[model samples]
Target: MDTSTSKVYHVDGYDSRQYLEHYFSDKPDLTFKDDTLIFPIENLTKIFKKGHIKGDLMIDLSTGSMIHYLLPSCEFFKRILVLKVKDRCILELKRWLDTRTGAFNWGHAAKLHVDIAGNSDQLQDTEEKLKSAVEHVVKCNLAKENMTDPIVLPPADCIISAWLLDNVCKNQDDYIRYLRKMSKLLKPGGHLILIGCLEISYYTVGKDKLHAFSYDEDFARKALGEVGFVIDDCKVKKRKAQSDLADYKAIIFIAAHKVK
Candidate 1:
């Protein structure tokens, strides 16, 4: 029930997916009718192409909706490491990867590893659930791992996180620490691409009353710079929906590279 550490919460014994479905059912603005989410996929594709992510090892730090958008394009990677801070996100990603007609390209030789942390559930059960959803042809290794602890991450050529920094970090120092940790996971010349909300309230996992840090683009750029990352290209856009009656404007999309 603790919002800080626990990644998932069950309501009426239903799983996280069921909880989300029920929570979003009443929200007119949040719609999941299509295969993809609300974000502009065309813009993401352009950013990916500009970042030159092909044939490189990629690590998705907080793979939320970005997983749905980027998985198909990531076929060229030698290996892809998806670190989902929330259990439900991991399950959703696993479901997508397991499907035969999903965005996943089975022809790729890349290995898929899904990491989940901040959950009270058994690790084995989580792994089994992921395994059951996966297709037989896709070469994937599923496991439950904690992101806060020291992890032997694969050498990634690029690290991409979408809407992660603002949610996980408690303050500026925590944000810096996260950036440093992610930098350590990347290769010397690897890049870090982040698409996040600049200043938005937290509304996910059935907690509609939660609040998040008011993120600023300048602070984020400075944080990346302090961690020896050069700002290659950055773009900020406001995401608005007619039915969404939120006070804050959504600032999305940012990309940076590690300084050699």
Candidate 2:
């Protein structure tokens, strides 16, 4: 099956709830838990603990309505500004933030974060803290020079994009272009943390198949460098779960700072 022909993310509509249920459920595929969930939690925890990624504001340009990636960041940033490409995603996030009924539960991921901190009792508090830190969920258009047009956001101390570029980028040029836009959102010397899958080109959300741009660690490093970011840390993990939901062979997490 040629995954390159799959529907591109953001260009087409997405089912936010289904995406969460499929990849972030209580018994998610083991590899996804290890690579996507646990890996970012651990890295963010370490980065925050070291006091390098904290500030008054942090912007999140994530793929879906996902908040698990920001769970560990709530402690460091006083405000979180989330930019979503789709209205459905914004609604999905607000549903959870408002604590509405039928909202997807993220207890499993929250527990993992608390467990890593060795404070298992803070599971509920962890979610609440993230919710408090997230100050806004605004719609964004990457095609625009000011992605969040009509609202010029203050430069952030940190920016985090997870599993986002792989879905929207059709080629290397697109990756670099989109990355530059993200870089503009950060203040000089501010950090950019990226989480993405490597060397595969498809993921399933319910019955729909979505496209993913395939690239290696070196290309990623070069892309970040080209976008004026200095690499701080890069972690890659081999696929551990054998699932057809996504064909990715590995996952990557990179921490870099925008060059002044």
Candidate 3:
């Protein structure tokens, strides 16, 4: 009788929400007091203004969940092309961008393009939410898809990848390849701005695990140099995380130029 013991199981919804929130929400450190995520936009605006990114066309790779929310604040770009690594983000971003009541003013706006490449296994549900929000969207993969190859891209004044390279790229070669591909997307003497987390560990979304690479100012300069991009001025800003459990507490922003 002693050998046969009953086992009790308990479930805590708070813990479950905490775990789920970790993946679904933005990094704790990246959030602001106003409840508005403005770091990416602020960083992009800083670089664009500093680098003089005014041009006829602008391309944004991996437009994150909040890009369209901040686009209106940036008045330099005449036309914006958003290339999302995952289809869901593209759909969500497009919906937000097209919404008249949304953060971005879509009424008096320039052309907006959305390219959906590769499906994200981690954020599938979120992707679905995004897909339902948009009508005109392109589906393709950034690595294998040839439809929108940046190499043969039409002349553009500038190209921007907001916190994208470090996530998709695995190693140095991958980074270089991405840079080269992006270089072909820009016109001569164009600029490229990369904003990423430095020394970050793995993050999870739902049940999926997303790995973060260690990228800093030096890494940006070196990688951009190999791809024929000149290091103009890299501004490193210290970003901190509010959660004590988080491994990474800070991040840096890198701004560089592509030379002819």
User: Which number leads on TM-score?
Assistant: 2
Tens digits of per-residue lDDT for model 1, 1-260? 33453231111111435434532222444443111133423444566555365545777665342343353344445556666655555655565565524433311111111111222334334333433322221111222233434545667787777656665566788678878878877888787877666775544444332444566888888888998998777776665443232234565566677774
* Candidate 2 wrongly placed segments (more than 4 Å): 1-5, 28-31
lDDT of 3 by residue, 1-260 (tens): 12122111011111222332342234444332111234444455455555366766766664344443224223565566656555545555555545524333221111111111122242223323333333233443556534365434466676667556656666777777888878877888887876666665544333334545566567778888888888765655565435423344355556677885
lDDT string, candidate 2, 46-85, tens digits: 7778877789999999899888889988888899999999
Better of 1 and 3 by TM-score: 3
lDDT agreement with native, every candidate: 0.52, 0.88, 0.50
TM-score, candidate number 3: 0.66
Worst 10 residues of 3 by lDDT: 5-14
Cα misplacement distance, residue 166 of candidate 1 (Å): 1.6
TM-score of each: 0.65, 0.96, 0.66
In candidate 1, which residue pairs clash? Answer: none
What TM-score does model 2 achieve against the real structure? 0.96
Candidate order by TM-score, highest to lowest?
2, 3, 1
